[model samples]
Target: MTLASQHPMTMFGPDFPFAYDDWLSHPAGLGRLPEHRLGTPVAVVGGGVSGLVAAYELMRLGLRPVLYEAGELGGRMRSIAFADHPDSLAELGAMRFPPSASTLFHYIGLLGLATRPFPNPLSACTPSTVLDLGGVVHRVRTADELPTDYQAVADAWDKALQDRAELSSMEDAIRRRDVPAIKSIWNRLVTEMDDQSFYGFLAASSAFESFRTREIFGQVGFGTGGWDTDFPNSILEILRVIYTHADDDQVSIVGGARQVPAGLWTRTPGRLAHWPAGTSLSSLNSGRPRPSVTRLSRTGEAITVEDSSGARQDFAAAVFTPHVWTLLGRIDCAPELLSVPQWTAVERTHYMNSSKLFVLTDRPFWRDTDPRTGRDVMGMTLTDRSPRGVYLFDDGPDRPGVMCLSYSWNDDSSKMLTLDDGQRLAVVLRQLKAIYPDVDIASHVIGDPITVTWEREPHFMGAFRASLPGHYRYQRRLFTQFMQRGEPDARRGFFLCGDDVSWTAGFAEGAVTTALNAVWGVLDHLGGATAPENPGPGDRFDELAPVDLPF
Candidate 1:
């Protein structure tokens, strides 16, 4: 796509009309350009979604902004492939966005990228889950439909879901230092529910049929790690996820998840600079003064960025958008700016190392089931494949069930990725048999397990950021106070924006939200200032919405 055809929502923002060709054609090649000023008004660092979105928003306002990305533009939405099996693809991180993600949907529409709704639920319990949960299950079918043995299964499920919400609210209150209040409510529910998992809660409730008791147990049990233990969350969290999973329409990008980033780079008009083929950031400046940058530098003056060949050029503001933990203490910044240790404190947040295995076969390996359930043949799992967690989607639009991708997490994929292709294929075959006891795995299994190593990606140390016990308040406060461009008059004019810095935690939407906040904050600070005369073509800032304080 050309500059003229770029999305007006993004193209004309603060960082528009980037020297498009220069940015992509070479790795570290910033290319030959005229001697512009030292810095513009805003500098956006890291070229991932957050950086791209921030720059795009800024450019829309007609601001001349400069973006710096140490590596490929898309931060974590990258895919991987096996050398021999180039046709097969595996997502290293961020497979798809749910339809309910309004922020993500809005951006997609603005960018004109086509999104295809996923035909399957986020996760479908597999047979392994069934086996693990010992199979019988129940639901609050209806008042009259209720089994004679149980008062009402439906009523019980509702009660449990409500109880969970109550628990979570109490937990949140306690975190806010409401100890007396927490103690008052704790006994009421804690005494009523005690320490029962959802499975145990329902089984002993006397509100379900013997069959339903077993089946519901199986459904919530193996599928999500047996409720309480596997999830360890309030019942509210469980119900919310269950409802969202059921109603939300999650979908994958047309070209693959990685295509989003590729599209951004292709669609955005920015100067592309490639470093010398084999030089690291350290080698670029051999014993010279590395440029001093404010965390949120806002001078409306351009700064020279020297590539490995010692070539230098300038652009207005720079925005930084990389992983909070990885970028912390690595990039140059004022010492006082490093006081926020929240990034380092939560480094060990529960993260799963995952491997996505895509297989191509001519036959429909999955048996068709209830159209609503979409579990015709195979089941999914949060546990080892069975009923706990495995999902299947029809690849009909692509090929004849020719492409199948399975995301294996935790110990399920740990040892498998290290093996040779032949060995990995052998294990997947075995596991598939466990998921579909009736299917012929050995006959039509045509591909090896394609892997994407989360542990290997340098910028991303783990999978998505997760909130563990006692971390919610800390997370909310961190994003609330620290993620902003330094005040224009402050000693350090810097702003941090990324998915890690948003309330939504680990998702693309968070990146946009954070970027939006950063943009508004910077714009407000610079609203009173004037730009240099003869600013380059397509350089200005669009009026952005005022930043809304989160309640």
Candidate 2:
């Protein structure tokens, strides 16, 4: 029987009908605060997607949320525009967004932004894909065109998922939003696989017994490219990515991915509580957000926050969305702000280093077809060479195009950190020329290359979190921070929300999900209520929650 026939309800994987947009648009709309609590001020740190989403939702709920940021508002959703070609953009951080990111799509639809299928390695948009490993180049028009050995690797991955993880049944429950069913399946898996590394899982699988097959799988992954670095990570983390289909059917915003949060910053709500109908997040902050938060401490029932400029204010509650290292090292946070275990969780959190280098081309030269072969001269490329992944962007035949020469992670990224922009561009161009000997990549370059090493950036210590094997207990403590307000001597007024604090880390949806959780937590702290008919996640958290790993 087909996989779908076995689990008919498994349509969209873990992306269920959470209806976050509907909850925000309900008649009561996240419920309202008491008359006296209206306009109660709340502090929001960081100006990234999470903090911006939290501030936006809180404002709609009759709360005055003061936002503080150390850098530009979009955070990792940064897009750099070419000097000569303003329409051409180079995404330094998040580029492709999966269709499974429902909460993010809600805002994308609301903002009236356009998106097109991203040119991932083997996607339809990618006219051709060249996979070069061990100096052997294999060109394919579709995934099926790949060599027979690659097919075996793909089949092995499928069999492993089904045999070890009960992939079909778990996915069926997740897609249907069957809370109890999901808990039952996920809880057992958490207990079974929590201690295993992704590499370990693969090694134990009978299908991947051949070391050569395993090596090929690591270098050239299924949807994207390369899983070598991820092999050391928790197997549970890999399962989450696969089960959610977070790596498939991805698209990028037409202008830039950063436009999502930037749009939210200026978007005016249809129905608001304390503010006027036209009041936007920008207007609420008097056209500029407060300075970055440098210190935080709890005094009585209120929390006091100090900014980089030494300005201070007290609020009943605060939300922190920056990398945990920022709180531990850059800011002077009081010990009482977090419990000992929570602090340990923060300290143990692992963030991956990422780097990208981009150049504006005079035209989409890669689209040109070679007469002899009848194939595009250049296409999306994955190589064992220094430049791991090469992506081409075409605005129009007449307009300038952008090319991401190199997008590397971890060690690949760190090696280039010491090189200046010019040096990095030279290295990338050399690598590209070596891969495509006939394509004159350097001559098409029309502007200076732009590069970003996320680790070297002081404001953002790293790109995103990647959980190590056996780190589930630490992650559980961090993910459950929103539920600790009621505990005695707990970090009552302070809440944490970010991709790092989510079960599925390193995705925009995770950031948005955790942000909404903090919003609900703040609502509860303010004595507000969620509508009974449309209960928020927090209202049913116990029933829908994932299993917590026992220490």
Candidate 3:
């Protein structure tokens, strides 16, 4: 195969080529609505990235956006600081970001936040990586240093991507934002691959004939670690991830990922339509968002939102950005808000359970060299042990540091859901001791351990959405909710926007792009139009829309 054919294509997926941040930053501003609609109020539920982006953009377009959140402002992008060392943080939600997430990076850059390359397994940022599988330890400084069999497994993955997915062509189109090329390549793949699972794709490929190779690939995946949990998920989802290089060239915010939304919450816009020159999202809400929306009732043209405190308010339109399950169960939503198909889509949405355990360390002791071997005592680790992945965070020699003792998902996370902090710590410590007998991890631990089981959290039932095989139709219905305004006024006024509603779930970029989609929806609903020079995603949605698969 030629060089181009040897690589898998990168796909922008449903995000397409729309640059939402650019549209919002346009000189003319998001197309003007009539003076009568300028001061109209709109309700934005779930004050996470989606809600914040929607509210901020709406406020700029001369609309009164009333934002509501049940818990913290950052939502899943939460970054918690240690009680003893406030400067350091342990990310409970999103930690790393890929450069392909242009929408999110736009906000990050606008906020002037600094980012450093994430120390993914076998990456240069990681001094070393230990792959402990089947009671065998393979420590390597790079992928080339891995055992011959492991190297073959990696090569097979690359070959499979090229042969089966057209990864190179897809990536080229995505990088150039070539909408036609992307659609031409991706539309065909959707028909061919939507119904398939990641594991099925692997099985069908010629890259791995032996079960051992397949098992090794699933058990110790490239980039972060094992991806066996994702095997049963839609191949489309996996394609989106690999195509966008979501697992490569990763970076994390200097302080925390949460700052992206938090910064936008308080940022002073360059242009203003109705609000004052220096008005920000926080100023618009008087520095406090309204309580969580407990109920949503639609009467004729308006939506009445009830908060946890029994307070009710009516708005011209409403945006729901919370997890689908929350909207389905936590809130007393009127059935008319969503169609039966939409409700079924929401009910059947699958969310992956994720858990993370972190501890504050006195120093970056892991960087110490082993006098005997002349290698760093501790590095990024991936093992079949209970603590599947171990990551180290160094904040200089003077300041205290943090260590993610264990980061797991699904059944692995479920195992630790009932364990207390001490118990979780003990489990991780024991696992680490087996992996690194010479390294004393427990001795460096300083403060109380912090752990989270996202599924158990009341506000967020799960960490992120992961679509199962044959669920493309359901996802399509969910994603296209922003455009379904042809019906009764009730359904027209209530819109859905979130990561779960996006084609690319579990990423901040998904939340941002979907929020922008809702912004355009709300704009069009209120009789606002996008400027011809800078058209929004809704403007070209049909041409660059997702592929429609036949069930």
**lDDT of each candidate versus the true structure:** 0.45, 0.85, 0.86
TM-scores, in order shown?
0.60, 0.96, 0.96
The sequence of per-residue lDDT tens digits that candidate 2 reaches over residues 1-551 is 65444532321223122446557656767776788999999999988888889999999998988999998889899988889677889999889988878777878888999999999999998889999898888889897999999989999989999999988787776566665676677778889988899999999999999999889898888898888778888998898888877888889999998898898899998878888889998998998899888899987888999998989899999999988888888999998888899999999999888889999999999999888788889989988777888999997789888899998888889879999999999988888777788989889999699999999888777898989988988988887788754676547879999989987788888888889889988888888888888798678667555576665
- Residues 344-391, candidate 1, lDDT per residue (tens digit)? 443534444555555545455654453665544443333334213343
Please give the distance, in angstroms, between residue 129's alpha carbon in candidate 3 and its true position after superposition: 1.0
Q: How close to the true structure is residue 459 of candidate 2, measured as C-alpha lDDT?
A: 77
Q: Write the per-residue lDDT of candidate 3 for residues 1-551, one digit (tens) a residue.
A: 55544534332563355666567567777777888999788999998989999998899889989999998889989899999688889999999988878778878888999999888899888888888998899888999999999999999999999998898787877666677887888888888887799999999989988889988998889987798878889988988888888788788899998898789899998887888888998987899999988999987678999999999998999999999898778999999988888999998899989999999999998888999988888888888877888888886887787999999988889999999999999999998888789888889899799889999998788998999988888988888888855776668878899899988899888999899889888999988888898887878778777777765
Please list all clashing residue pairs in model 3, or write none if there are none.
Answer: 7-168, 8-167, 8-168, 9-166, 9-167, 9-168, 9-170, 9-171, 10-170, 10-171
Q: How well does model 3 score by local distance difference test?
A: 0.86
Candidate 1, which ten residues in sequence have the lowest lDDT sum? 10-19
Greater lDDT among 1 and 2 belongs to 2
Candidate 3, backbone clash total: 10
Q: Is candidate 2 or candidate 3 better by lDDT?
A: 3
**Backbone clashes counted, model 2:** 0
Q: List RMSD in Å for every model shown.
A: 12.3, 2.2, 2.3
